[model samples]
Target: MNFQINKDVLLNNLIVAQKALSNKTPNPALQGIKIEVFKDHLVIITSNSDIAIKLNVKDSSLDVKEEGSALIPGKYFIEIIRKLDALKCNLSIVADNMLRIEADRSDITLNMMDLEDYPELEFSEKIKSVKVNVRTLKTIIRQTAFATSSIENRPILTGVNFKIDANKLTAIATDSYRLSQKEIELQDTYEPMDIIIPGRSLEELTKILENNNEVVELHFDNSKILFKYGNIKFQSRLLEGNYPETSRLIPTELPIRIKFNKDSLATAIERASLLSSRDGNNAIVKLSVRPDNVIEITSNSPEIGKVLEEVYPVDQIVGSPIKIAFSSKYMMDALKIFNSTEITVNFTGEIRPFIIKGEYDPEMLQLILPVRTE
Candidate 1:
């Protein structure tokens, strides 16, 4: 392919497309990006079999010299574009399967992959699409994706479960130890869907979406899900299986409720966790509800030291006093999701899973299971 494009424009899209590049794949073409040059625009596609990204650069952004196609190594090609100091870069297929990049004082030629060997990514534009606000989608991922299981022992838990019922879209993620759930009211609804999206894919999608109020179009089939926004189309393969019914895990009645300042509680827990160790299975923080409407957070490490901090709740403590121990890391993860100044912690009992929720955001719930301590 031959084309003259603005350095920044090409670099920006390359950086985004690189998110889907497969590094360890045995297929040589899968490790590179396929560039298709048309009369009006250039298409860049990258995929690792599980996740794929296709970006379009309009003719207005580039000076098309010839209409052709080429497959360039994603890693080296992107690096060259990023390092180029010129405003515009010239790309040409100087020889069969060889691509050359020329900018101001720099000239480089890289061996290209065979386009025939590249995987054909089938994406239909006529598929059913759903519109969701970018900010809302980003918030949903940020709040719940972190709680997904990192290990693949249980493939379902490694993805975020998305359930669409009427106008509400609920996202839930859990590693059995803790769970994070967030719900968003959709502007329009047509059908209900229950699908599990890989956490790693959602995390990458979140990075591509803008933080503004624009809308993103979502399209999905039985196996793959597509997210289209601006000039980019991101597709991910859905995990097969039924996600665990997380609603039943939430307690119906939490008697011991404490509403504390979010910042105060987070800081106390962070300080307390300094003495605990994950390797020793002692990263536990004890929460003791005092009669004086104060909660004491304490952590003890036999090899290290101990820490104790008292935090007063914004609202008066309700129900009887109770003491519970949980993973400090889990508490910190839940706290980081809340932007509200005040948060509520609901405890069903000393051993049962407790929930942390923001006072202003009732749609989001964070649950942490208590850890056993002698």
Candidate 2:
């Protein structure tokens, strides 16, 4: 294909498309990015089988000398584009399957792969779609994606479950040991959707998206899901199997309630975790509630000394006095996801699962299983 595109615009699209290129694949063509020059737009596509990306460069932003297509190595193409200094770069395809790229002072020739071998992203005419704000989608995933299971034995647990109905959209991620759930209302009513998206895919998508107020179109078929935002299109395979039902784990009645500053609780747990090791993965922080509504956090290690941290709460509690031991890592993660200044920690009982919620709303909640230190 022959086209003259702005160096910066080409470079940016290459950077995003490269995320799907796989170097270790058995198929050599998979290591390259497919560049298609159409009548009015240039399309760049890359796929590692599991995840695929397609980026478009409009004709208004570039000068077209000829219309064609080629598959060139993604790594070399990106590096060369970044090094070019000219406002626009000319890409021309020549005889003997050679691709020529020229800019202000640089001219590079690369052996092009057969364009026919490059896999094309499959899209269905009929699709179920939903609208989500780009900013809200990023934040919701960031808050819960961290809790997804990293283990390989249970592959389904490694993804975040997305359930969308006429009124609400909920995203839930858990590692069995801890869970995080974020729910928000939809702007308009639509069809119901239930799907599980891999955390890794969401993580990569979050990185490429800019911090702006834009809406992303979510389209799903039987096997794959597509996320189209701006000039980019991303598609990923859905994980199989039903996600575990978490509603039963959350208690309806919170007998013991305590509201504390999010930053203070996070800081105390971080310090207490310093004494904890990988094997134990445990930090026993004892909490004692006095008659005057004062709470003390104390942790002790046999090899090291003990630490006691005290933080005053803005709201007082009237529940029975209690002491609980839990994973310091889970506590820190749950606390970090709380965007509000104050977070409420509720306990059903010392041995039962405890819940953490944002002070202002119950839409976002975290559940942690207390460990028996004795």
- Which of the numbered candidates is closest to the native, going by highest lDDT? 1
Candidate 2, lDDT over the whole model = 0.83
Off by over 4 Å in 2: 125-127, 277-292
The numbered model that scores best in TM-score is 1
The sequence of per-residue lDDT tens digits that candidate 2 reaches over residues 248-315 is 98889998999898898889777867665333555656566766677777677778777777767668
**How many clashes show up in model 1?**
0
Candidate 1: where are CA atoms >4 Å away?
A: 277-282
- Clash pairs detected, candidate 1: none
Model 1 per-residue lDDT tens digits across residues 1-374:
68898899898999899999999988878988999998789999999968999998884658887999888888899888998999999999986668999999998999988788998897655366778999999999999999999887898999999889988999999999999999889999759899999999999999888899998988987798989899999999999988888889999998888998999999999999898655355378899987776789998878999998999889878889999998888899999889888999999998999999887887999999998777
Cα lDDT for residue 274, candidate 2: 69
The lDDT of each candidate is 0.89, 0.83
Pairs that collide, model 2: none
